[model samples]
Target: MVIYFTNQTGNTTDASVSSFTSIPVLDYTQALSPTTKPKFLAQLRDALINVGFLYLQNPPVSVATQDALTQKGFELFRQPLEKKLEIEMVNSPHFLGYSRLGAEITALKSDHREQFDFATELPAPGPDEPLYRNICGPNQWPDETAIPGFRQATEEYLSEVDALSASFTALIAESLDLPPTAMDGVFDEPQQHKLKLIKYPLPPSDQTSDGAGFQGVGAHKDSGFLTFLLQATPHRGLEVQNKAGEWVSAPPLPNTFVVNIGRALEALTGGVCTATTHRVSLRQEYFIDADGKPLGPRYSFPVFQGVSMDLSAENITLVVPDHIRDLVKDDKVKSDAEATFNKMFKTSIGEGTLVARVTSHQDVGQRWYPDILAKALQGQKDFVSKQ
Candidate 1:
């Protein structure tokens, strides 16, 4: 192994000791305190340096709240296409809203279901920071009519994870062998971050007819510092390919987020970490009854934490590889987040990208989508009552 000081990615750990096919159970609050900080940072550094996936459990948010969010999301998704269409993602141009399959695409392929995407509170950067000057803005919330607590819940989740991000980033600064508050100035204003609730519905087995991929979110590593993900396990959907090119399951855990560092983080650390490849394929389970049988739904919420576009999470030292140390800007560098995020959603300049491309009818979703879903559920209850 070419262990370069600049190359902080060091060596990939023995998966035999840390590999995860089953769910990982961990409590962030306990794992993140100052006393355990050293050990936790070492483990975290190792995980990012090798496994690239950390399963978490017992996050600050309760199971009930998360379940409620999921329940409300599915109910809203089932509402009349007309009612849900009222608040379209296209309305904001930043691309926040509900999107059906074909609305989101990754790796140049379209995804197979609907989802909601929103970043946490964004701060305006200085005039010199070109990236944030335009790209940073408050989230575009759906009108309360769609779902009374939708915006509030979404915002709350963001806050919870945002705090987690702050905690983790501080630890990372320490793991870099710097002072406790080393990263304070680095991520001064709330770090540029986002929170998402993605529900991958059971696609019709016959969905080959559609251009979308048979999988939910495709195999793609996050492009930022770190991602904390919570998923439903036993359902068997998430997969991460190892350095050996082997595919493994990312099963659900009780409460943790499946965390991983992105390429940018690797770049920041000067390759001291691993940003392993991951992907979701069309399930090949043999349908015993017949074709077109639907499987169960799969849900995941991945909260991404990042530094300002101008702040590089990576600041390699001379002890590291020259290439690694070079990642830090000797002179001011620009952040790629603005263009990258804009392109991901294909929205107007500075408007964050929606998950998928906009067709003629789908215009607004955030204006009041959450309320629409609630109303849809009410109608369902009413229908059942009448029956």
Candidate 2:
């Protein structure tokens, strides 16, 4: 059941809140069935083309498993500050591990949430491998003694989401009127998947000054193919930007996940599906703790599934159907699609994501990846500076 309130997107103008329309909801069970597939595909296409966001009901992950993971997430966060810091992200060149509060910068501002990121548990790349391959290394796990079942629950949950995301990608291909397996190349073996365990610390006050208050997380768009977010608590904050530039709040619903397209999909489709921008905001009630206080942290688990990092442009197949390609008549979009295609073919999705990380989280880049950070800055200058 998707509960959409009559809340106007943030931009609605009225003495009383204007009624905003609800985002579309897709029934995952029907979507995967032969009998209901055509209808499901039609709705899926409509949802992606129109809103680029939707509520996925009856996901592959069970409610009980989700609850177990949520409890584990809370347990991990509840560890003593010293214990939590043992696997700090700054220590990992691959950008795995925990990020303390105020460490992640977004939209040129500090995000008020701390998070732990885990990716495919692979071995560290050899020294001779491409620097970007460094991101493919093993994740930094918390001490099982300190947080028993944390690793087991997280790994299990990630595996479930990973399988579901792969299945959904094939459905996306079907919805686009392509061969059901047309999107398979993106998820070739060794594809990188990330699960983020995030906790948004409650704001001291409503003030938006000195970076001391709630910028729970600044506005941004996901950079991967598809993102599935599981909200453990009912604390409201997540909002999605609509076509009219209004921000609509997406509150938590039982057995539903708020899914959104990411930048890679937008590039791959030549703008047919958008990479919608969204952000998090905090309300006083949800701010259960005072500044420097910890009442109960708001937790969110977002799983990002993207193409194989090693995939190059030459090996990548852009899946925009001819009809969709014909619809992309805008010269700029065409150019961007071409450029992105060429860049990815030559480098890889792994490189693109790495560049994005360094650009957004400069401190992380500077500390753990200074060499790559310098190269990125040089590339930026060459691209934008007067010739």
Candidate 3:
């Protein structure tokens, strides 16, 4: 019933929200040299504090890299349905791989009319962590004969992206006032993270059905720390919700990665950097352009940069005020936060499910820490001599 993509009624611009307003573009281009580093950092710090997202231009990657990846991507997406399905998303445990149209459940009431996913190539882990034996595993892809140069281009694009993401992580740490060592122990030793190359293709006009992309993608907040989106050159549909609960068009900016802070940042900061809601806006088929003809579908590519899931959320105890903590203790605030987070990943919270995550709609917070830390310390001390 609720239209999530483009808000039904409200202001639609960068200043949509009262708290998380759109920030000025931070020109980090001068970060290349040692002398201008301070100036670059100042701009970055201001942007992060005011808005969790930024438009990154002149990033580490070159223009040639973008063009190459975009070309190879088109080839892969245009492959026959059977070939595309060879390494389908349904088969990937972590939801990594090529997906078909209507594969997303964005609206809750209906599936979105588009498909996108991620890929990662981490190295094999040593015995220190067996759970991640497959963290640096192979990416399953359709045979190259069907889509020539697909494998090579994709791998190259992924490598460049990985390096770029790491660079941004270090810079973000600097912005947060933490020593660069702050990133230690958080990422998997082998450094594996989810990286997607999205493609929102054109939709059909004559007929509409389960596959029509009108509801192309669902509305949701990002789940990780930061997302670096290399937008489609001709993109138009991306939208972000502002503080006032209104939707504003975030059309792709050329030569800029639409960067956004995600839930991990919010958790680490104890809610300082709010996880903003965003989704791809699907223009109806009947919607006409200024030319008096129906407009075609738009495209966008988002790469969600992240650390290992096994790591604990960052401790932002110092950032939040005592009053917010009190608000977090209230029944409504606690329940709502937990439920909202649970729904983001489609996990459960109620009783009787296999995992307690779904069932415990109640808030879990620092208030429970005193009692928990007391028992934990006793257990540690009691076990010290047994060894």
Best by TM-score: 2
Off by over 4 Å in 1: 1-38, 122-134, 186-188, 206-213, 232-234, 282-295, 312-387
Say which prediction, candidate 2 or candidate 3, comes out ahead on TM-score: 2
Q: Supply candidate 2's per-residue lDDT for 300.
A: 89
In the range 259-364, model 1's lDDT, one tens digit per residue, is 7776555555545555666765545351121455544566666777654444431332313344433433422111333334334324222222111222111333
lDDT of 3 by residue, 1-387 (tens): 001122334433332134433434555566767887777665565455445566776777777877777777766667778777777765543344665665544433333444435466644445585332332455667687776776676667667777877777777666666565555544555555555555555544543454323545666777666787777555466666665555556655557677888765555545544566776755553244556675444545667665454543232223434443343323432344444444433421111111111111111111222343355446556786686
Query: How displaced is residue 25 in candidate 1, in Å?
Result: 5.1
Off by over 4 Å in 2: 1-5, 9-21, 209-213, 285-295, 324-346, 375-387
lDDT of each: 0.54, 0.76, 0.54
The alpha-carbon root-mean-square deviation between model 1 and the true structure, to one decimal in Å, is 12.4
Query: Clashes in each model (backbone N, CA, C under 3 Å)?
Result: 37, 3, 11
TM-score of each: 0.67, 0.86, 0.69
> Which candidate gets the maximum lDDT versus the true structure?
2
